[model samples]
Structure formats: structure tokens, C-alpha cells
Target: MNGTGRIQVARKVVGVGSVGTRAWVLLMDTLNGVEPLFLQAKEAQPSVLAEYCGRSQYANQGERVVTGQHLMQAQSDIFLGWTRARGDDGVDRDSYLRQLRDWKFSAPIEQMIPEGMTFYARMCGWTLARAHARSGDRVALAAYLGGSNAFDEAIADFAETYADQNERDYAAFQAAVDDGTAQATTEI
Candidate 1:
């Protein structure tokens, strides 16, 4: 995995000022061990973004790995497929939240974080929505996040319910396992 490379395709449609610059830098650092293929939209100071993305340093052994994302989604899909084949487990909610925390400080401009913050909230909401759809538990996910709002209402509801049920399920399972009433192939 260390030798693997990541191709990052990002758009500056929202804006390329300090926020965009910071995002580019963080993406580069986060993927340090791997080869980086970067593609910046032409609308966002194309020349400057290209220069930064393609910069070569002596420390990198003169390897210029960054490239444009002309192919965009196709390239992204291929790279994702390759990563999946390499046994990289997809990011889960916990890991996603951690990444958000890291991005907050690493971002180029702190004030440009409102949108980014919303992204995390939306993710949480989506996860909770899915869980609710599956378990038919209206308040399960919402309780986890505390309150109901456009950002993470669904998750908060689902989490609240899930916690209640999960507690009961876990207690029963643990008692059964301890008493040898439940057969198991391994200990959790």
C-alpha cells in the first residue's frame, strides 16, 4: 500500500482562492507515500494550479507524478477499483469523521470550512437514513447525534434507536456466550 499511488481529481468550481490551495496541499500530503495524479479544472487559474500540481522536487528523486484530471470520473473509478483490489477496506463512518477532524486544521483557510463541515454532517445524515430504512427505526439514528436538523437529523434519529436495541442485543448475546448457550467459532 505504501508504494501505491493515488490520483486526485478536484474541481475549483466553488472557488480556488486560499481554500482550494489548502485542499490541494492537504491532498498531496495525505497521499505522500503514493504517486499523485492531480487534475485541476481550467477555470481555476489553470496555469498556477498546474504548476503547483506538477512541481518536481529533488527529494522525490525527480519523479513528476502529478497529472491533469482530463478523464475525471473514469480515472477516479479505475483508481478506486485498483485500491479496492489491493484490499483497502472502504472508509467507514468513524474513519470518515476522523478525516474531517484532520482536514479542519490542515485546510489552507479556516474560514472556508463551513462548506466542508456541511459535507460531514450530510454524510452522517445519509448513514443514519440508510440504517433507518433498513431497520424501520425512526429515532434510532437521530439519537446518536443528539438532535434533529437538516444536517444530521436522520442519523441522530437512527442512532438513538440503534443504541437502545444494540444494548439489549449485545447484553443477551454476551450472556448466552458466557453461559455457553450460544455456539461460536471464535471469541469476540
Candidate 2:
């Protein structure tokens, strides 16, 4: 972005859940300020669920994320990549980069109409089924899911229980931090 572009700026991105740091980067051509490219960088860390799911084969945590995205989505962002860099504290970190919005749309859930929410739910189900079909045995999926809502309800129940456990764990961690037994750093 030197002679080709004028200056590149990085803006802090908020609201997104990340294990570590996240930011939005903008690159623009200084000459006309017309050529603009927006990129998102998110820190990658070892997954908390990895212990139960099994060890990842990717050397870098970023690669694990990239691979999972590719497998779960029919189409992935064109500018997806991964890199490692040394932080100011002399610690190496892994991060993944992708276009901020390649072909995406979003709307507040609170603003969605009932009909629209139903349609959206159907679409989400279809997309998840497709992803499972691509990565798992179709015959087995058909057999497991069957022709009823039993499997779906079971999955929902499991998710609720899992979330309750996670909340308990988080509360314990917060108590430790409050008691000065553990330190929680919110900003870097």
C-alpha cells in the first residue's frame, strides 16, 4: 500500500465475540480515494471445546478456523488467509484475515416480522442440512434425523444444558478474578 495506495488504517471492531483481539482494516488509494478494500482480522486461539472434540491437525489455530469455515459454508470469502506475528509482549499470535463483507446481508432480529423469522429459520435449517450432507454420510444423517422433530428437540435440549454449564464456569472464573486469585485483562 505504498506507491499503489496512500494509507491504510485499522479501526477497532466491537460486539463480535473473539477469543482475543479483533479489528477492521481499511485500505484506500490516496490518489483518488476511490479504491477501497475493507478487511477483518480476528485473533485465533485454541478452542475451549477442543478437549472434548479432539486435537486439531492444523499447526496454527487460524488454519483450523479457515478449514472449518470452508467445510461448513458453501462459499467462503475470497480474501481469506492466515498469518502469525509477534506481539509487543514478544509473544507470537495467530490471526485470520478476510473481507469484511464479501456478499452478506444482515438485519436486527428484533425488527424481523414473524413471517420473516419463520422463513429465516427454514433457510438456516436448509443451510445446516446442506453442510451436514457435504461433510457426513447422507444415509446416516437421514436415518438419525428421521422424519420427525425428535432429533431437533434433543439437540436443542443439549444446547441449553451446555449453555447453563458454560455460564456456571464463567461465574466461577469471575469470582476468582474478583478475589484477586486470577487476573482478567480486558484491554491490550
Candidate 3:
């Protein structure tokens, strides 16, 4: 809210990691409703790694999330911010906000053949490594990893197992739907 604007609507939204969280898409406009900006306000709870990594240093979870994103990304969203609000459950919640969507090119992952897919995977791997390195965890993690391919192999095995689980979960869901135990609709 760097300038004058009015909120148009606040629509509830949810996704994979945000299930049961108070998340919303805030629609707003300025200049007599000619320009519209959609912001996604997602509740920031304790990090999933908190049990193992301990709590974040920042007092506000939203601020911690925003700070981590800033540290991790080379080009973060200009609208990235954080705030506190009273949730529908009458509880105070911290949330991180950012542009709902930003323009950028995405690889044609589905269209890639096996060789292309391998290249894309390596590209993605390097990008993630670069981000982690930039975030100042490079030295400690590198020292812990030492000089071996065991960690790499373990990660690869874990990824394959995770993908296999996802397939099985989707198949079970489809089976449940087919048996009338569950329902699904594509018309969302």
C-alpha cells in the first residue's frame, strides 16, 4: 500500500501446503478501478522444519518468511511484504503477502522428451544449488556433506520414492472416486 487504493474483494484460497491455513487473494484497484492488482496473503505458521532446525530468529513468522525469501531469491517480488491480522477463527495470525502472479517464462516441462527432461532437471538442480549457496548455508552444508556421492544418491533415492508415493496416492484417490467413496470435479 505505497499509494492510494481501495480493496475490491477478498477471496479465500488454498493450495497444497496451505490447507487449513487462512489464505486469501486480495483484489484491489486504483485510478477509478482501471488498474487492478491481486495480492496473495498467506498465513505464515511455524516453519515445517522448526522441530528439527529450531525456531526462526525473527519474532514474527511472516517477517521470517519474507526475510528468507529475500535471501533465497535473486529477484524477489517488489510487492513482497508481511502483516498481522485477526483470522476468521478469532486468532491473531501473521501473513506474508506478495503479487498473486508475476510474469516470467517457464520451461515447457511437459513437452520435454527424456533427454530434454534430463537437461531441464540439471538446470533446475543448479538453480536450487545457486539459491542455497546465495543464502549463506553453503559452507556448513558443504562441510557436512563432505566429498562423497552418497548424499547425492540418497537424495535421488528419496526423490524417486516420493514420486512413487505421489503416484500411488493419486491412484488411490481415483479409485475412491470411481467407487463412489469420493467425488471430484474439474470445473473449479
Q: Each model's TM-score?
A: 0.24, 0.66, 0.78
Clash pairs, candidate 3, are: none
lDDT of 1: 0.40
Q: What is the lDDT for 177 in model 3?
A: 100
Estimate, for each residue in 111-176, the C-alpha lDDT of model 2 and write its tens digit. Answer: 999999988878877888799787778898798789999988998899799999999999999999
Task: Record all residue pairs in model 2 with backbone atoms less than 3 Å apart, i.e. clashing.
Answer: none
**Lowest lDDT 10-residue stretch of candidate 2:** 19-28
Give the whole-model CA lDDT for all candidates, comma-separated. Answer: 0.40, 0.79, 0.89
Worst 10 residues of 1 by lDDT: 92-101
Root mean square deviation (Cα) for candidate 3: 3.2
Top TM-score prediction, candidate number:
3
TM-score of 1: 0.24
- Any idea what lDDT model 2 has? 0.79
Give lDDT tens digits, candidate 3, residues 5-113.
Answer: 7785465768787788777888888957798889889889989899999988988899999999999999999999999988767989999999988776779999999
